[model samples]
Target chain A: MDIDTLDLIDQYLRGNLSDTEKEAFEKRIAIEEDLQEEVLIHQQLLAIHEQEKISLTNTSYQQELVQMNEILNEEDNAKLSQKIRAIGKNQQPHTTVRFKRKKTVNWFYSAAASIVVLISLFFIFNTPKALPDYYQNYVNWEELPSFTVKGDPEELFEKGEVFFKNKEYKNAVATLSIIEPEDKWYPFALLYLGASYDQLNENEAAIATFQKLASLTTSEEYSKGYWYQLLLYLKTNQKEKALEMKTKILENPNHYKYKEATELDF
Target chain B: MENTERYIQALIQGEDQIIQEIYKKIYPKVLAFILYNKGNEDDALDVFHDALMYIIITQKEKRSVILSFEAYLFVICKNIWKKNLKNKVIQTDVLTLEEKETNLSAFILEQQCFEFYIAKFSLLSENCKDILSSYFNGLSYEEITLANAYATVNTVRQRVFKCRSKLIELIKNDKEFQKIIKWGA
Candidate 1:
């Protein structure tokens, strides 16, 4: 801690000490605990100083940034900026805000007649209801883990997955159904099976598969079955059943699709 | 990683195809982060541009291999935006291109100080760091000795005192330390 000790430590660090002096200092350092501590501090501080010196003097990195920016910002590189801007725009939340039109034309008979016609049309058109485009809006199929088939030496599930992804629902169903029901992949097979049926407009088969899957309470995929069943019921114009399913989901706040169910307009 | 190197190489070479792919894939993440942190699309674009340039230039100068390109790029963009948000001049909705450049350079200078500390600290001896960490974790000298398996309690006490004084001395004499003090004030 004293100046002489500090000076000795500094000399040792800089290799300024003669061989005899350095040897003597090491011997003393072994017995003198304070010397070891001082030596370590001096060595560390010097290392820090050397690092800082290098960093402060290295100005090329900063210049490179400016140069690279100029290159990227060149007029011809406008396409790059446009691509980035498009990406930014695409990432914005897609919330379609529908504005209800005010009924300014208030002639009583016409309004009443229009209301009745609208009600009748609503009932007629609401059955299929375009299925709410859940495939586009909710199903991020690529993000889902692929079904790993046990003893699938032929990679049948891989073919099914590719078929499903490519909109070949019939092929997906046929390939997926080849896996036996007792196989570990049966549950996942059922998922794509139901989805493929849904895609193919075979609502009864989709509903049946989803119903069976829903009953498998211990499987992690149980929630998907309940959800798809609710969706299929809606698609099949079974409003009462869909409502019951929604209520069942809402009964437990922990339901996977509880939030989506709560937000369902129908 | 190969993916990291590919991105870095793309930046260095200014390959338009790979760079466009980078923009399409990674820019969304930067945009989301910026939006979550109270920045608009323009602010996010500015930060992303600067961060990309920073990476490109850093690769050309240092050629250091980043462990994760996406994560590293996000951190750089985060730092730049944070500094931008804190700048008094940024209260104005619009900045001229020259003003933007000046502001960015100021951020880079500020960030260099942080980089200096991280680089230096990472180079410290593990034993020295452990002693300092133990003391800060509120371990007594006897506890530290027991934890570190030192020969005696006195050795721990000596190491603790040594580390503390060394830390103080390093901080006091650090070039960035003075800049940080001024900036805080």
Candidate 2:
């Protein structure tokens, strides 16, 4: 297009043209296809330029979101640690009462009783061949390789993974929960989310998340989710359900967790 | 129309509560669609954010609403996700017939053209960039002159026009721009 026509397009865009000139320009645009094309491109370019500015403003918003996530995770971690310490403190009085009862018993009988209790406690704490023992033997928490994609969301994923790897279950849960459900990392996030909940002893939440993950037929993470659910049931002393999951794993021997599932005692 | 307008207004204002409500209401379907189509939650989130940004920009620039908010947002998200999954084989059932019925090609073209312009805009001189940026940001001629310390309002106007024209010239000369225009046609 010529300079005058370009100028006219710019003026029209800025609403700088007079009424008569605007009328004439509109008529020319209706008749002249090239002029119309030029006008459209100009408008699109202007719109894009404006969009660039709006996007610039979003940089700070993205930063704030990252900062907020970190702060929230820290707060949750602190609260969880405090609760765990309080629970430990509460258990101390029960142990003291048991110690006092042992002191008040007759000397000869207490000696005999102590010997039996020591053997029983040793067997109970050190050599249990039960579900909890199997869980302790089989549960190996490995760090998932950090899969970084190009975006702000990836930062959250990485942070959540770090918390998971560090065994900061509460922090991991807080960080991963902020990730949008539609994110590609969401299935992995859900997997870790359920694992974190399990570690924190939030059995119901863990089971719920694992169930949700298992329900997604399209997810590559589905089989892994089912396997985790099976382990979770075992962890929670649900032997019947764990056996059902064992059957599922045995049925699909080619599943990712098939080998591990085969070795599980229950 | 009223619902769309309210949504658009909520977006422009960056109302966190409404935005959260939007996510709660709409994101699950988008997430399911992405996951089924070989996309992950990450791709879905990125597509949704980009789509929302496009809507905000379009609404602000046009000062008008045409399509329903849900339809417009879904179409934008679908197009962006398709673009992201260009190399992957997509399922035909990803979008329903009703969604496919929306004439989203125009908006898609506009987005492409905008992206192209942004890429080319970075190549302009700093002075030209500032002038054009200020102009597009709706700065008054007098305000632009005051900000940039140009001699007169007329000078600012001329410089803004010159910078915009230069941008157009650069875009016209670009091979990618030619391809985009042809593809858009």
Residue A108, candidate 1: alpha-carbon lDDT: 24
Instruction: Give a tens-digit lDDT track for model 1, residues B75-97.
Output: 88988886777663547667887
> What would the DockQ be for model 1?
0.07
Native-to-model Cα distance after best TM-score fit, residue A245 in candidate 2, in Å: 36
Q: Give me the displacement of residue B58 in model 2, in angstroms.
A: 23
Compose the digit string of candidate 2's lDDT tens values, residues A1-266: 56567668878987999999999999998999777667766776666655421121134434533443343235533343233233323222111000010121123233323322111111123443566565555555563334433342325555566667777675566556655666666777887788888887888888898888887778766876777778687787888887887788788876646776776654
Worst 10 residues of 1 chain B by lDDT: B176-185
Q: Write the per-residue lDDT of candidate 2 for residues B38-154, one digit (tens) a residue.
A: 665555655666576556545654564356777767766876776556524544445542232121223434464555677688889999988878777768779999998999988
State which candidate has the highest DockQ.
Answer: 1
Against the true structure, what is each candidate's TM-score? 0.42, 0.35
Candidates in order, interface RMSD in Å: 13.2, 21.2
Model 1 Cα lDDT, one tens digit per residue, A71-182: 5556644454455445445434332111122122223234223321111111222333344443334443343345433343235555566678878775566456655666
- CAPRI tier for the interface of model 2: incorrect
